[model samples]
Target: MPINSSLASLSDMAFGTAFVIYLLAMILSVVFYVKAAGEKPEGAQKFIGMTQSLVWLGIIVHLVSVVTRGLATHRFPFGNLYEYIAMITLFAMVVAAIFMQRREFKPLWPWVLVPVLSLLFLGGKNLYADAAPVVPALQSAWLPIHVSVVASGASIGLISGVASLLYLLRRWQPEGKEKGFFGKLAKPLPGAKRLDLVAYRTAIITVPVFGLGIILGAIWAESAWGRPWNWDPKETFSLITWFLYAAYLHARATSGWQNTKAAWINIVALAAMTFNLFFINLVTSGLHSYAGLN
Candidate 1:
């Protein structure tokens, strides 16, 4: 069945509104983090807890908005650039929350959540478009499977990138009490060596799933477009991203590229993924033009 145009428009409005709410929550969280930095012994804990609560609330609303939009469209909510970004941001938040809770990586929350919030805002402002029904090319079972896995992998990449950034901030801290906001922020971040290990762990978890997603994408392309590799801009960039991360893994395992250097390579790999998802889809034209804003 086709979605009613009017209903789709309303859903978009709700999603956009929810996105704004999430952005506001992120701002509040950041403010609290700043305040906590200057607070006394007990006040800091309360501020952090409040900030975390706000973040959680924002995530809940965001999740509901995305799920409703998906149901209304009668397809996975990743058929277009807008939905793709929203889903990716959602996955990133989920991964961050889970990792923070499970691995006791609470100190990394400020760094990780800020980027997730930024992505949410970007998805709403830059990528927002009317949700439409899926095209014939995207009306395959593999569509959701492929996108979900890839998005999760991208979430891991996001976490790794943030960890790398934190690692850099911590590694360069100055001596004495003149560390400033960034210096204080760096205090709780894992050591440079630990940050490198965490980043590699994230990439290791993501790379194989990303590889599977690409392989499945190729199979789906063969079935739909009659070719497994079309040399599309998106495909090319994705392959490049895969290879970059692959190199990161190889260098770490064999070439002895560890610490800041490995973190830098992970940052580059994540950048390639971001460019493939955002710039290639928006600025360039190709088979993935289907991802462009309407």
Candidate 2:
């Protein structure tokens, strides 16, 4: 059955609007962080509160947009690149919000989130197609579960990468001295060890989910395409990314590779994941060719 074309477009427009609002919230967050760095904690807290409220508002709007799109399309909406980016960004926001609630890592929100939110909007604008409807191959019930889990794991990996970047920027500076763009920025950032631990925790929690996503993906592939392993570019890169994190986990558990070195590994793993997600989709062709811009 064909989807409701008008409704699908409306949902996309709504999501775009929400994404713009999210970008604005990120700007406010940056302002707050800058002010806080200058010792104006009161004003910073107010702005941060306002930013948080706006983030929640954006979340609600995005949720409505995605749910409506799924309903209108009458499919899982993970069939194309635009929808996948939307879902991935949403998952990242959720993870960030959760971490902010528990950790003192709120300072990293703007630098980490704004780029992702912007990319999601760009992807939606350039990659989204009309709800052309899904084929029989995508009608399986496992589609949503598999895609959602994988997206969640990717979100955690992204946040871990951001934290690792911040750690490196801080660690490279001389003790009690700040230099360079990142070094100047690091004055207000959390301690290097703290940032590394945050990255470590995020990666550790995500490893199991990442493993599950790959396993479930293999199961789905076997069911849908009659093969459990295809050695596609995306698949190969994803396995590499998985192994990178697995090594990190093992090093943390055995060799005392804490702090800067662990952070560097996180950055490397994230780079691989980013290559798999963006470069592989654009420059390479494979079973994952559905990721092309429309």
Among all candidates shown, the one with the greatest TM-score? 2
Q: Model 2 — TM-score against the truth?
A: 0.92
Clashes of each: 0, 0
Clash pairs (backbone) in predicted model 1: none
Judged by whole-model lDDT over C-alpha atoms, candidate 2 comes out at 0.79
Candidate 2, residues 126-197, lDDT tens digits: the string is 776666665466678888988888888998898888888888887876436877665557766777788778
Model 1 residue runs over 4 Å out of place are 4-10, 17-21, 39-41, 102-104, 174-182
Best by lDDT: 2
lDDT of the candidates, in the order given: 0.74, 0.79
Global CA lDDT computed for model 1: 0.74
Per-prediction TM-score to the true structure, in the order listed: 0.88, 0.92
lDDT of 2 at 228: 90
Candidate 2: where is the Cα deviation over 4 Å?
39-42, 174-176, 292-294
